[model samples]
Target chain A: MQQTRTVELGTGLFVFLGVVALFFLTTQTTGFSGFMGGDAYRVTARFDNIGGLTTRAPVTMAGVTIGRVEAIEFDPERLNARVTMRIDGRYDQIPDDSEASILTAGLLGGQYIGLGAGGSFDNLRDGDEIYLTQSAIVLENLISRFLFQQSQEDQDD
Target chain B: MSVLRELGESFVSFLRILGDMALFLLRLVMYTPRGLLRFRLVVHQVHNTGALSLVIIMISGLFVGMVLALQGFDLLARFNSEDALGTAAALALIKELGPVVTALLFAGRAGTALASEIGLMKATEQLSAMEMMAVDPMRRVVLPRFLGGVIAMPLLVAIFTAIGIFGAWLVGVVMMGVDAGSFWSQMQANVSGDEIFEGVFKSVVFGIAASLIAVYEGYRAWPTAEGVGRATTRTVVLTAVSVLILDYMITAALL
Candidate 1:
């Protein structure tokens, strides 16, 4: 009985240690976490449809996440998703006219707010709101639109 | 010609049947009472699954980490980027290999034990005896094992990652004479929090799958001794397959 108990305890310890090692191994593979809160600058963008947007989602400028989505909300009257973002503070000073479009990081990735720099001289300050926002291109809508256009083009041809 | 069409129809029918089964499973998961909150059962299962898996998890992780270091060093040496060996090993262990291999080890060990124990119980009419005694077998057996597996898998995954990374570090920094500072510093930059979360998520699911299959096969075991053997065999195969399937689906979406 004692031997069984001892063996069990030893096994439990081994499992515990192994899992800790696994996490350590993974964190080293993908180099993303820096000084968590210190890396990015914050801003807000609003959209009619956020779709799969969630907090902690990437806020990319020119396809690089200078920040992340901090919060998401829907206004009752407007029915639009109001997204707050924290961008890398150093990458700040985009002119107020910069456009934010929702984009997929990949085929399986959730939506992220992508910023396009504009030609305006005036730059966006911290706590500033980005007004020119484009929502996610809904996949179902795009598929239907493609099929309909294909049939139309066929008829025309 | 008619036979070909009939075969095609049958194939589609089979696929639709599988889809229906999947939907039922989804509903079953959805409707499962929050009975997973029994802390003692959870504790007991954790002790069982985790304890049973410790030595194998540790040794496997260690060797995998070492082998990764060796292979990574060999490959990266060609690129003169041998410095990235630590980071590469870390990522593979954390994201893909660690949980998967550990769960695979578990699919052979604790998973087999669980199936046999439950299978034997069924063969001996012990499970039926419990049912007659007004004992909720699912609550008493399945829930504990399932919860334990889910919790323990992640914990073991964490252990594997830590040890594996350290093993890589040892091989790279000490044995191979790679600079310790660069090896570790690069790791800090390359390994992201989100990746860790993804790894953890995968392992947890793997654990759940292993536990569920073990219990399911065991519980469904027939009264014969052969049934017990069949249950054990099925448990391992199903658990391993489930781990691979779950890994693919989760990683595909997460990435």
Candidate 2:
């Protein structure tokens, strides 16, 4: 009986440790803070090209993340890409005229939306769309353009 | 003609074993509810399988994580993006290595023990003795151990992953000159809930497969010393191959 009790206690401890580890993985390491629906408000932006922007990518202001991209869809009516972002409720003072731009993190890192605050007195609210938006810069387009300009310069010479 | 006949016979035997395993699994599932009633026995088996195997799991996780950091740093330094080490290491550990490695270790540690123990009991006629007294050996013996393994597996994987990340942090931040802030923040920013779910889901599937194979092999052993030895060996070999194959299938399906 004593041996059985000891075994039971040890098993209980092991299970408890396992649960703690799981909690840490989900909450701290992965940064999953449960459902985001209630604590955040949605805003929309339109860009000419999204260029590998994925849902759940960070939405940052001055390099500090304040929200995440909730959805990306093709705007067939406008012939552009529509992006929906969920900004944290605490950051409710974003100006109505703020510029939203898709930017890459490092030279080859993933892309995220970077928001530049505008000076307008009006604050953006949920369901509001930012009209001033910049699209993602495609590397291939930049390279081809640079090559074309260099060839033109050589021809002139 | 003789070689073709031999190949056909082997194929038929393979199908026969597969069908037998399926029937055994069905019987095991049917007895599971009755086995739950004997919860104390299940807990004891959990202690035997889970707690007893904790040290090896932790040590192995630490070493694996350390190696990943060392290799990852060297590879990423060429690109001048060593700050992404945390994200790289954490994602690999959480998405792939954690569940797969832990399952392999579980097969080697607990699976063999369960197989050999049950095999020996059959060898000595202990299981038959219980049957003579009207106790269903399936419920009294097999189901508790299986349930214990299934319950303990996710927990073991979770612990292994967490320790692995810590080991990476120890090497990348403390020993190496990588920036500590980026090490953690990069992981938090990039590692999502879906990847963690994938790891947990794989662990559960692996747990069921490993446990079921171990008990099935032991229950159907030949009731002799040589038979028991062979059963234990088969349990390890079968569990390892199936876990890896299942890992690939699950990853492909999830992706």
Top model number, TM-score:
2
lDDT of 2 at B86: 96
Worst lDDT run of 10 residues, candidate 1 chain B, spans B23-32
Best by lDDT: 2
Q: Assess each model's interface with DockQ, reporting 2 decimals per model.
A: 0.28, 0.80
lDDT at residue A117 of model 1 (Cα atoms): 90
Clashing pairs in 2: none
Model 2, first chain, TM-score of 0.95
Tens-digit lDDT track of model 2 for B83-155: 9999999999998999999999999999999999999999999999999999988888988989999999999
Model 2 segments more than 4 A misplaced: A35-37
